[model samples]
Target: MKHIFKNGIIGLACLFSFNAMAENYTIGTGSQSGTYYPLGGILAKIWSENIEDFDMRAEVTAASVENTIKVSSNKQLAGIAMGNVVLQAHEGIKPFPRKMDVSVLFALYPNVVQFIVPADSDIKSIKDLKGKRISLGAPGSGTRVSATNILASLGITDKDIDAQSLNYTATTNAISAGQIDAGVIVGSVGVGAITELAFTHKIRILSFTADELKKVSEDNASYQSIEVPAESYKNVSAFNAPAVWNILIVNKNMDTDLAYQMTKVAFENMSKINQVISVTKFTTLENMNKLNGIDLHPGSLKYLKEQM
Candidate 1:
């Protein structure tokens, strides 16, 4: 970080004394098959190609909630997580033990709540899931938390269905083998897990009623209504569902100059990142830096202000 800030600023040398070695870093992303991993790969490649000596890599783990925890605990490591999970991490909500010192850089995309079943199945609506086996997403993931809340809003509880905590691939396999009735996935508009399922088995996406959507909105401010495009996947058509915003987050204690540099480099080459994952379309200069209830990193804030 020697050249991160121009010389002659007061206390600059003292500040650099502690933040001197800015070498290898990592971003805690989600599963390799999910968007976060690829998104991280794109950013890492861009930074290594465009910037100097910034050796970065993507670490696959649980998507939102785990990413938030890792970012809060480690200063050098950043994360890609859901907006609501980031908020929960910073505020020390139900899932978090205590308030975490975290901040956001830019917004990602939305995690569309998907309830998928075999195309020919008779499970018509959320109501039909009673006494059926369903995967609610792997434990400690944002999908699991969102799945539970979404079901609660729809008047479905744990007792109403046979709950299974499984990841996307596991859920997909179970549904394919007829071991489960349906699988709940929370990802972008055309998540790979559901799309992959369409290859071997006919898939049907369930739509949330307008009233159900309203109830979800009232219960969770982070989620929004969305429509999956028609024929986005094989043997599957369009459907409406609720979605949650995903964001790139970092520890507030991270080096401000490094954070600023990362933010600037990312926006300068947003197209490269977007090419790898189309969901980045939701991230924009107009509002990328804005988060729900958490603070934005001071360096990221500076970069956004200057871009204007």
Candidate 2:
């Protein structure tokens, strides 16, 4: 009995030691209804399962801008952010008060800027949105920044429209209820909020003309010209739109081995990730190099170099 008690005590001590050694970190993700949230949870699970003594949790945040700021300030170890916002943060541009030490882990997917308007509305083009009520996404979201930038390129500024800041769900809800004339959403193709709204309401997605695409590209290289494939949403035809890559970014201060392991595991488990979120199909090494402005993390760089 004495021997059994001693062994039991020893086992308890080992369990305590293992638990104490586990490192828990938070991956800042967008609102609960957004893609970033589930993706963050998938990633946290992947890292936790594969990495020894590592624990990660997904935190609901205000999306790109907030994630970039938080990750750079070391408030969170990592985050998913829009490539353009990351560039702005890196360069200390407006909306970002100072230069931040942020490095990309990888490009997760392209977030197409989707403009939604009621189907029966007279608004045929984004220009018609002038003097109309529109939601540009939540204040700290990358959608707002992208919408404002694209609109400005097309000569529609804040003064031209009644701009509202609402999250994906709220924006779609308001549109479905005919409260807003239009709204802008930035997310991977088949974003949930847009998908849900499409089912109940007849909507039209505004396409960017070649001239508008060229102008926006000239103004900001981060925006890419892409086509939304037909049937991506119910009754919505394929259309050309500008997109920005959503990337996993981390504080530059992250430990080399930890970052390396995270990148390696992420790439290796792309299949598993896709199972959780189909949009992760775009999360590939080829697309990883697409974000040119932000520097890659040294650990990620080392892993990528090994692949070469």
Candidate 3:
């Protein structure tokens, strides 16, 4: 009887040790009011439900810049970031505080630039934004960086515009209250904030001309020309929109098995996710192959190799 009790205690100890070693990873997502947050929530739910012995959760962050920082620090196992910003972060560019250990899991989708202005507002064009109060998205956000670059390409600098560094919610409120003339957001079409704003206010989306689009692509290698179909918003007409890509990144130090499982879940569910969100329609195996300049996590690469 004594020997049996001792063996039972030892078995319990081993089981507890194994359970303790099981990892629960968190994915750093964007603002609560944005698409990334919802998408990240969905991903976490799917992963936790489908992947064995691994738990996942979504953390609200200041978007791409903050996400990269968290991933680099190993506070997050994975994150969602704008593609261009990911490149910049890896290189320790102006916005990123330091070099990051960010690596790609996949290229998720394009984050099109949508500039919303009051219908009666005189800001009919990007060039007309001069001297007008505009929300350039939240501080330390990829949207803010993209807005800055676009304005600079058009010769509209901070000195030329009344820049309000506000988040999507704040910017939406400012525009509704007439506190600002325009608000710039980088999100997928059919964004919740933009949709809600359109229901009550008449807004216009200023589109980039072909020449301006050309110039933007030439200026930033990370940007790509994309089209935002008409009827994406109630108040906006369909137009050819130019925008940048948003990528999914993982911490370099993440456990290989965990990363492999995560990547496998993402690709395997891509088809189903696409059916739910049209933005995901663009996420294809070919596009994954097109992603450049970033190293794939070794586990992710192994999965990709098997697919090939």
TM-score of each: 0.91, 0.93, 0.90
- Candidate 2 structure quality by residue, lDDT tens digits, 1-308: 01011213222122325436666689999988779999999999999999777779999999999999988777787899999999999999979999987889888899999999998989888779899999999999999999999999999999999999999999999999989999999998899998998899889899888998999999989998999887899988888999999999988766677778999999998899999999999888777767987778888988999987
Q: Per-residue lDDT tens digits of candidate 3, residues 2-55?
A: 101121322212222444543467888878878889788878877877776556
Best TM-score among the predictions, by candidate number: 2
**Model 1, range 129-223, lDDT digits (tens) per residue?**
88899999888788888989889888899999999999888989999999999999888876787777787788898988889899998988888
Q: lDDT values of the candidates?
A: 0.81, 0.87, 0.79
- Can you tell me which runs of candidate 2 are displaced by over 4 Å? 1-21
- List RMSD in Å for every model shown: 4.2, 7.1, 6.5
Clashing pairs in 3: 230-238
Best by lDDT: 2
Q: Rank by lDDT, descending?
A: 2, 1, 3
Backbone clashes, each candidate: 0, 0, 1
Model 1 misplaced regions, further than 4 Å: 2-22
